[model samples]
Every structure is written in structure tokens, then in C-alpha cells.
Target: MKQSTLSEVKSAVTPRATLLVIGVVALQLLFVVSYVGALHEPKLRDVAFGVVAPQASVEQTMQRLDELPGSPLDPRALPDEETARRQIGNRDIDGALVVRPDGTTDTLLVASGGGRTLSLALDSLTGDVLEAQGRTARMVDVAPASPRDFNGLSSFYLVVGLCVGAYLCASILAISAGARPANPARAATRLGTMVLVALAGGLGGAVIVGPVLGALPGSVWALWGMGALLIFAVGAATLAFQGLFGVIGIGLAILLIVIAGNPSAGGAFPAPMLPPFWEAIGPALPPGAGTWAARSISYFHGNAMASSLLVLSAWAVAGVVITMLAAVLRQRRAADAGSSAAEAGATEPPA
Candidate 1:
């Protein structure tokens, strides 16, 4: 009997266990590919830059910037120096070159907090232009980064932490109960739990990143809201996947959040610095949107907050709908099976 029981246990564990291991391997491989591919070469090209000068100098400056080799700078002429500064602060452009009225010296305004690559690119490109005109240039870092925000990467780490917590918590939720719950009520409870978890995660992350670590400087409440929404959206999506796909759902969550999301997130490189594929998809996905929004909130004047919130909301709603539907269908099937078995048993003769 003991041997038979052990054999049965092995039989039960073998298929799913093997599948789970394979899924893990696949996820690990994907993680390596995504991270390496996205970050292997970090260079800036076609970064939006502004040029400001008198009418006589404007044409020459624009031409020089446009003709810069490697096409690193996409410079457009601004009407005045004030406009250039405004645009840079609003994130409309990365940096600006201001030509003096006397045409002897020029000034370059750059936001170092945005990215060091872009700032350095602006400096190099502007230096070339000024040298050609026999004029010198000075750099002014208008939007300087905090000393603690190394590479402007703290926001990315904080957001990733929240995302990881979300999906892991979701996986735990599935394991504690059935992957596909029996009814909408249980699905609703799961959602409620997710919300609670989101609240804790958001507040904890905000406090840690702000007061404890001094990594990010932003309104605690604003960061808290963003963190909560980000976590809940990721968790809800993971739960929906588990509901629809069983144990494979955890693997799928990892594939989406870690493998696909991280590299395209524009954490290491801003949008313009990424490859075509990552640049195109970065703004549309959760991680990318979250990163952009986090940066905007912390640095910019909350310009892109609304759109980010909408993207997160869409994920949360879709996850809830799919989870509830899957649960309802699963319960109906179980009910039908129970009813049919009862009827057949009642009609059959005794064994």
C-alpha cells in the first residue's frame, strides 16, 4: 500500500511539475534576452532639441544642428530663448541652444535629470555648432537630478518593486484558493484583497523611496496613488491570467511583467534612446507607462499623469471582467456535473 501511494503521488506530480520547470526555464531565457537586447547599446539618436537665436543666426544654427554627423540631434528653431527654456521644462524637448544677440557667446540649456546621454549629446552637438561660428558655448543644467537618483533610475526600481509584489501576491492568491474560483463572489473577494494589497504596497514604496531612501522627491500622496494603481493593475492582470490558464498563469505573468515589460520600459534609456521596437511599444505597456508617469510626477509637472492612469484602469477592468466570467463558467460546469451524477445514481440499480 505504501509503495502504491508513493507511485500515485509521483504520477500526480510528474506532468505538471515537468511543465512548470519548463515554463521557468523559458521565462529565465526570455528575461536574459529582453534585458540584454534592450540595454546592450545605449546611444542617443534623433533626440528632440531646440535652437534659439536672432533671425540672422537662426538659419545657420538650425543647419549646423541638422547637419551634425550620425544624426544624433533633431534640432528645430525656437522663436526665442524663453520659449526654449519653457519647452525643455515641459519635456517638449530635451535641451535647447540659445544664441546671444551679439553672436559672440551662446548658452545651452539642458535637463540633466532627464538623461545624462541626452545632456551630453546636446553639449557635444552645441559645441560643434558654436565652434563653427567662432563663438563659445556654456552649459546650464536647468533641471538637475537629485544626487540620490542615480542615472534617474530610482523611479524604475521602485515601480518594478511594486509590479513584482503585485504579481507575486496574485500568484499567492491563486494558490490559496482555486485558480478558477467557483463564482463571481469569490472573484470579487479576490479583487478586494488585491486592492488592499495595492494600498499597502503603494504607501510602503512611496515612504521607502522618499523619506527612508531619499531616492525620489515627490509628493508622497501622488506617488502613493501611482504605486497603488500600478500594483493593482499588475495583480489584477495576473489573477485574470491564472483564472483563464491555470498553473501556467504564473509563468505568463512573469513573461509579461518581467521579460517583456522591463527592457521596453525606458528605465535605462528614454524613449528616443531605445530601438525602434522598444520605443514604439514602451508607452503603450504598463511598465513603460508606469515609468513615464512616475518620472513625470517626480520631476515634471504631472503633465502625463492622466493618460497613465487611464492605461492602468484599462488593465484593471479587463482583468476583473475576465476573471469573473471564467469563474462563473467554471461553477456552472461543476454544477451541471453534480446534477447529472445525482440523477444517474438515483436511476441506477444498487451495486
Candidate 2:
């Protein structure tokens, strides 16, 4: 019995299997680090904020805000309260402080629709500063989040759902067929299937969030388009990963889009409020980019989303290129193998 058990263990723990297990363990550790590092403690950093005050005191206010320890806010002088509000609506600034020269009470304008946590942080920080100066400030939400949109998380969740659908659909398609497509035509067909799946998933998610759940309000068509692009980007990227690494590619896709991408996505915390590593990487990843674009569509009138769109487009294009390249390489290798086999057979002596 002992000898049989040792044989079974040796057979089960092949070198390849052992390496994959180690890889999985590493990925698990990375997931914990990414989530904890991103969410452990949130702080304000380089939040674009506006200050509206009389010409005489505007410079002083800007200077004071700039000199705050940690330099949490990037303070600029707006011409008036109206301009500050307009800038917030246009997604140019996160929050603004309006000074009342006639009295000790000031007004702080924030758009919670952008991010509730960030708006609250701005409120608290500005309030503390005002209190220290023997002044009081009133908090005003210029662009309030919908009641159902708790902490403005609906958009984040929607994007995450779309990403999950995309990768899963692509993974299923890859598994049903071979990991690498047999030829360029098969590769094209796989991509077409992904596009269709993305379209359906994207529109479904938009409808569920906007009309069905009332968690977000936006132009359904715009949301649909954004969703489709987001899904295609994720799906195509997953397909490409599968083409490159077979079954292991699925794990790689999960690692990139879920483990590393979700925490860095600014879903739970806005980019400026997250730790530096996550904040720096957020805008570049699909989940982060999709979340930003979704929020823009919902609240900011689709403003300031060009960069996010470009990032998604880059991912989609790269995925297509990589998938096609892998298919071509696979076809070439198969053809070479067949040619070698035929040549060897032709040279064999008659039996």
C-alpha cells in the first residue's frame, strides 16, 4: 500500500503540473496584494479643484491650498462660482471651493456623481481648512449621484460585469474549438463570434443598469456603444491570450483583467483616492478605462472620455493582431510537420 501510494503521488506531481500549481499560488498572492494595496487606506492626492474668490483673495486661497501638507489638491482659480460648476459638469474639475469675502461662511461644490468618496474627502478636507481659519463652509453637490447609485458604484459594477461576460464568452469559444484556430479563416470566425457576443452582452448590461434597475441614467445608445467596445476589448484580449498559451491563457486573462484590473479600476475608490501604484495603473487597464467611460456617459455627458476610448481601442486592436499572428504561426508549423512526415514516408523502403 505504501509503495502504491508513492507511485500515485509521483505520477500526479509532474514537473509541468508542479509549475502550474506554483503559478496559481503566485497569482493568488498577487491578487491579495493588489486588493489590499489598493483598498487598505484611501487618501486624497492631486485632485483637480477650483477656487472661486475675489481677485484679492483668490491668489491667497490658491496659495494656501497648494501649500497644504501632501499637496492633496491641485487648486486653480476659477472666474466665478458658475464657471466652477460648469467645469465640474464638464468633468474638468473634481471639486471647487467658493469663498465669501463678506462673511466667514464659504461654499464647497462637489460632484458626487463623479465619486462619492472623493467628494466626501474634499468636503472633509476643505471643511477642516476653513475651520482652522475661523471660517465655515457649506457643502453643495453640483452633480449629485442618483439615489440608487451607492457611492457611484453602479457604473463600476456594470463595467466589471461586461468584462466578466466578455472573457468568459471568449474562453468558451476557444475551448469549444481548438485553443489555436486551424487557420486564418477560423480565427476570423472566432473573432466574429466574439463581436456578436460582446454586442449582446453590452446592450444587455446597459439596459439592466439604466432602465431595468434605475441604478444609472444615461443615453441607452451611448451606453450600449461603450459597453460593446468594452466587451470586445476584453473578449478579444482573452482570445489572444488563449491563442498564445492554450488553457493557461485563461488564467492569464483572469489575472490581467480581474486580479490586477479590478482593484486598480477606481470602482470602489476614485483614482486620486487610491494608493499610488493602483492609481498609476488604473487608467491603462480595461476595467478602469471602462468604468471611467461608463461614468462619463452616465453623469458627465460623455465628456473627457477620449483617452478611455483610445485605450479600449488599443486593446481591441492588439488582441486582433496577436490572435491572427498566432493562427498564422500555427498553420505554418502544422504545414511544416506534414511536409516532414510525407518526405520521411516517401523515403521508406517497401514492406
Candidate 3:
């Protein structure tokens, strides 16, 4: 009985099944590692900061900021406070330090609308430095966040919602039909369906966040366009993954887009404040790119979003190419197999 039971267990756990189990375990470990690694430490790095002071003091202050260890801030001297405020409003700089000529106190201008965590970090860092020099600093929010937008996270959540909608919808479509499309025509049809779904999902998300909820402020049209692009890009990528790897491709998409992409997205903590690994990979992933673009639309007047848009576009293009190519190859193989079978039948002996 013991020998029979051992044989049964061994038969149940085939090599292929074992490998798949191993793969799942690896993905699980990676999910934990990626999230923890990216979010464990939040430190400032290369934050663009403006300085407003007299000609002589401007250079001196900038020099002092440059000399800080790790070079956390990229400080530039603005001609006056008005320029500093204008630049902040335009999203040219993250924050500014204005030195009072007559007193030891200074003013730090921040925009919590961009990111509350980042603004707080700037305030803390500036305050510490000023305190060390026996000076005091007051924080002024140049561009405050909307009361509905807590921690400036509305944009991030909005993007994340769109991303979820995209991948989930694509995965369902693949599952309902064949994992790999039946043929080129089927693939085209699946892609076309995805496009329409993305368009509607994008517009709906934009409307909910902008008009219905008033959680985010921006051109609703621009947000709609961005949402559409983001949804299509993610959905197409998921489709491509399913075509290439079958059911396993769904896991691969989750690993890339959810496990790795979400934390690195700078949604909870801006890229500058995240650890190095997360910060480096953040802009390349769909979630990260989408979050950045959404924030730009909300707070930056859509400035500095070209790179993000390009990244999303690349993903969409690549997904379409891969899906179509995979379908074509699959169809060719099926046709060749059928032809070979017919030839074999023709040569067979008569019963």
C-alpha cells in the first residue's frame, strides 16, 4: 500500500507541474521583494529647487545647497520671488527657498498639488538646514492641493484604476476566446474590441475623476486622451503576453504590471523620494508612466510628459506587433500540419 501511494504521488506531480509550481513560487517571492525594495526607503535625490535672493547671496546659497552630501537638490537661482512662483506654477521646479535679507528667517515655497510627500520632504530638509544655521524657515504652499485630493494621491489612484481595468479586460477577453487567437482575423477582431473598450473605460475614468468627483483638476479632454492611451497600452500588452505564452502569460503580465510596476510608479512616493532601484525602473513601466502622465495633466499643465507618452506609445506598438506576429505564426503552423496530414493520408495503403 505504501509503495502504491508513493507511485501515485509521484505520478500526480509531473516534472512540468513541478516546474510550474516553482515558477509560481518565484513570482510570489519576486512580488514581495519588488514591493519591499522599492518602498522600504524614501529619500530625496536630485529634486529641482529654486533660490531667490540678492545677486551675491543667490550664488552663495546655491553653492551651499550644491555642497550638500548626496546632492539631493539641484538648486538654481531665480531672479526674484515672482519668477520662482511662476516657475513653480508652471511645474518647472519642485520648490524654492527665499532668503530674507534683513532677518535670519527664510521662506520655502512648495506645491503640494504635485505631491504632498515630496513637498513635506522639501520642507523638512530645508527646515533642518536652516535650523542648523540658527535660522528659521517658513513653508508656503504655492500650489496647494485640492481639499478632495489627499496627499495628492487622486491622480495616482485614477491611473491605477485605469491600468487595472485595462489588463483585467484584456485577460478576460483572451480567456473567453482562445488564449492565442484562432487566426489573423481573430486577432484583429480581438484587438479592435480592446480598442473600443479602452476608449470607453478611459473616458469614463476621466469623467469620474474630473467632473463627477472633482478630485483632480485638469483639462477633461486631455485627461480623457491620456486615459484612453493608458488603457489601450496596458490591454494590448496583456493581449500580446497571452498570445505569446498562453495562460502563463497572464501571470507574466501581472508580475510586470502589478508586482513590479505599481510600487515603482511613484504614486505613493514620488520617484525622487523612492529608493534607487524603484526610481530607475519606475518611468519604464506602464503604471509608472501612466501615473506620471496623469500627474502632469493634473498639476504640471501637461509639461514634461513627452517622455512618458513616448514610453506608453512604445508599449502599445510593441503589443500590437507581437500579437499579430504570434497569430500569423500560429496560423502558418496549423496550415502546414494540415497539409502534412493530408499527404500522409493520400500515401496510406487501402484498408
Question: Against the true structure, whose lDDT is highest?
Answer: 2
- Model 3 clash pairs? none
Task: Give per-residue lDDT, candidate 1, residue 11.
Answer: 93
How would you encode candidate 2's per-residue C-alpha lDDT over 158-238 as one tens digit per residue? 999999999999999888867767788888888999889888988899899999999999888999999999999999999
Q: Which candidate do you rate higher for lDDT, 2 or 3?
A: 2
Reference-based lDDT, each prediction: 0.84, 0.92, 0.89
lDDT agreement of model 1 with the native: 0.84
Mind giving the per-residue lDDT tens digits that candidate 1 earns over 1-351? Answer: 999999999998897798888889888898898888888886667889898878886888788778777777788989988898788878889988888877577898997666666677678867876787688889998777678998888888888899999999999988786666667788888989999999999999999999999888877899999999999999999989988998788889888888888888878788777777777777777788788788777777666578778988898888888888988888888899999999999999988
lDDT, ranked from best to worst = 2, 3, 1
User: Could you give candidate 3's per-residue lDDT for residues 140-173 as a string of tens digits?
Assistant: 9987878899999998899889989899999998
The superposed Cα distance between candidate 3 and the true structure at residue 173, in angstroms, equals 0.9
What are the runs in model 3 whose C-alpha is more than 4 Å off?
1-18, 348-351
What is residue 152's positional error in candidate 2, in angstroms? Answer: 0.5
Q: Alpha-carbon error at 52 in model 1, in Å?
A: 1.5
